[model samples]
Target: MPHASATARTNQMRALMGGAFLPSFLGLAATRVWLQVNLFASYTQSDDGLFTVVNNLAYGLVMVIGAAIALRKPFSKGNRTTVAWLGFAVMTFSTVLILAGKETGAVDILAVASVCAGIGGALGGGMWTAAYVRLGLRQSVLYGFLSLALGSLGGLALSFLPEALSYTVSMFMPAIALLCYQRAMKTDVGPQPAPEPIYDKEPRSTMLFIFGGLAVFGLALGISRGFPAGEPVPMDALQRVVHQMGVVVISLFIIWWFIVKRKRLSFSFLWRIEIMLVAAGMLILSVFPGHFTGLAIATVNIADTLMLGVLWITLQDVARHTTTDVYAVYGFAWASRVLSRDAGRVLIMVLGAMGASSYAVTAVIGIVVFALAASMALLLSDGILKLRPLFTEDVAAPARRSAAGAARETRRAEMEGAGASTPAPAAMPSAQAQPDPQEWFRDAFDLSERETEVALLIAQGRSKSYIAEALCLSENTVRTHAKNVYTKLDVHSKQELIDLLQNRE
Candidate 1:
């Protein structure tokens, strides 16, 4: 019976993880299929600049409006589910419209579907992003990476299927994801209210600056991603699949190594890498044009998708401070993302329409913009860190604390051997003897699971590098978390934090 019970418990754990991942998987799948089939492949034989631009613009506009409305309205599980369901239905219809348009060469049908899919995607993406955040940062980032990888694979698989069948399946996929999401929400705990709203008093200039910078970065990447309008190359479908698969495999290993294992780059460094990849990718596409363009484009797409995950994680960190509906903050961010991507697509289409000379001009412009975006990344990363630090406590926090505890015991033993007694730690007035300052600090500040670990290490006189090593995070991330801990405890530095915890004892 015990053996059976253990097996049952393991199964439940697996189910919980899978359920947590459903929304991101489906939301990403929806967009991936739409882009691959409608934008990339459909336009291979003809000038799809108009269709692509309209579709992206319509998509962006809907998100902006929907996000604004969601801000004013209160969030509830039922409301989010309802929106997901409606989106599933509408987007499914749009998929069908796209299929018909492809078969009959009707540009009008495709255009209308763009508007419909745009609205549907905004509803679904906004809700799903909020849900992803509720899962915590590590799980959310892992799931996003998996989602993009699987979604890309899924898009490739769909390309093999007949148009009608693939379209039908694509339509159903989002609905299935929403169903899973509804089920997950049933078992999920709701978020706690933040002590203060971060965005409520944010300056208008700050908002504009941040969103505008993101738009510029997005535009540069967007235009670079699109292929110049031309005759279809004799590239084999098998070769393209191989290129994409290779990218996916390489990306997975890189993500696991840097993020999951080493925690090498801070959020700031990661964005810099992303921008550099975009710049390099565009240059390769422009220089190499027809030959090996598939490989270059695949590389760019993978980097772009990875960056999207980073962007979301950053936004969640920022939004965590909001006292209002957290989804509203995410909604606004998503709107910015949509607007940036669409604006790039529109700009590229306009440039492509001019002449072949404009193609070189586009490449030159992309290279220039990429340089500018790279510079902006450094500046903006610092700003984002100040607003909400990305590096702090992570998945390994508990293990790090255990190691610290063990080290403390070893040191105490060494002291005893030297004939020195380790005195009892500081205690509060009017309080009984307390053991773990960690728990005391946690309860006093109402810190989250992650923050509590950080505070305990800080109180123990751990350095930023030490805390980062223990927590399996980059030093910059540790600093960010320390800043957040100080803010929450209403203290300014590690000494003050330690003092506060001792006082609360």
Candidate 2:
């Protein structure tokens, strides 16, 4: 039984890894290498940050437009697929233009490429966001973290490849991402109708708090990137590799904390960490100027990577629980981040062009850092940070029920001891009298027959081994079914399942 259980876990991990690869590959192929090495280098001749500003502006606008359209007229499955293919084609053509411009030194070609890349990338991003929404919370987090880790590794590997080879490989990333999307379409089920209320009582406030926080963070990131400190030091291949490694390390730790340890990670906790990292990085940049620039950059990258993972998870959670169009939610959230970052970058550039003194630049950094800290504090004080339902699992419900159950038991015992004529407890309801909870949940969540059986045994307090023996299935198969049941029911454990059933009764 133990061996089978281990095997089942291993297989599950493999499946998640497989699912994560395409997204990670797509990310690798789409932006990091191409943007940094090709476009940025080429455009630096005209203006160091012009390409980035244009790229980000175009990207943000596309996301906003796409989201607005989706809100007004949600795309059918056929339309979504068609749009995604179009996006893939556009992105590929953009890459070709970039290469052509690089070879021929045509600034116009690169400018057009930047716009194409941004539009194409936004379309592709929406498609991926929809795919993630279908995975729910836990699966989405796992897949998200794994994808980040894999993308980091891919980036690290590309650092070793010759520039020509790397650029060549990058051109094919959109096609690979599309292939992965197709694979997901075949293997995964469509989004099920939510049984509970989809609309929140005060969704606008919740969204403002969440997306507003992201905007501040993004602005800080942009300031850090654009800060003038003796001409920004371009990260060498070694530095790039180290940066990627740091991302990988951080991604693994988050996966362990969120998935393996199953800890409750509040958004407040995430914000606190990010604020500190950004503040520290900015302080370092201000004090040292030219020295330790890599260290400062590394801190910013780590903070951004962490924020991005949680942000994606939070977006998915909101989309799942709310009536707001999922595409709009994702699009607006992304735009908020991107556009704000662009604002910060542009702010710094304007200041630099104005011949701002070092002291003034330092002052600006301090103000941005202060704004971030102040915003985070406001969020915490407003109870917005405590909005776990928008990000983390609400395990407190089960804990509260457990405590209430104990109190009821104690009250019943006291009543009996007092010799009062308490009414006899009603007889347990039969399957005919009340629908079997396992069967009901099965129908509601669209759980398979095997999952229904597993849930029933689990609620009865049967061990996995015992259930496996009774059902004549491998422990691994039983374990898989149990997991599916838990995910479908949105419960964390067997005890929660039991509490849920009792409540239903």
lDDT of each: 0.59, 0.66
lDDT for residue 220 in candidate 1, whole number 0-100: 65
**Model 1 lDDT on a 0 to 1 scale:** 0.59
**Model 2, residue 491: C-alpha shift (Å):** 20
**Best-matching candidate per TM-score:** 2
lDDT of 2 by residue, 1-505 (tens): 9997786566545433323333432342343334433334411111236766777788899989988988898878887898779878887888788778768989999899778877776776667776776664556767776776765676556656765676677677677778777766655442232323244565466667767777877888877776763234466665565566777777777777656654544556656767887788787878887787776766766676566666777777777766666788889989998899788878878887788796887688786877687657545432562332344331213344345446556656856887756643453224224644544666567987677767866765567876775566899999889888888889998879866775574
Question: What are the runs in model 1 whose C-alpha is more than 4 Å off?
Answer: 1-49, 189-205, 227-239, 254-259, 262-265, 358-383, 394-437, 440-505
Score candidate 1 by TM-score against the native.
0.69
Tens digits of per-residue lDDT, candidate 1, 1-505, equal: 9997786566434333422334433455455555555544522222244565566576677766766666788667677767777867776777788888878989788878767766666665555665655554444555666666766677667767776776677767666667656655554532222223435566667666667666766666566556554322232465457535644664566457544453433666766667667666666766877676665555555555666566766676566555656566666666676577666665555655665476566765655466456547533464553343453333233554465467567656766876765543443212234434555566567787667777776765556776776676898887777778888889877667755764563
Work out the TM-score per prediction: 0.69, 0.72
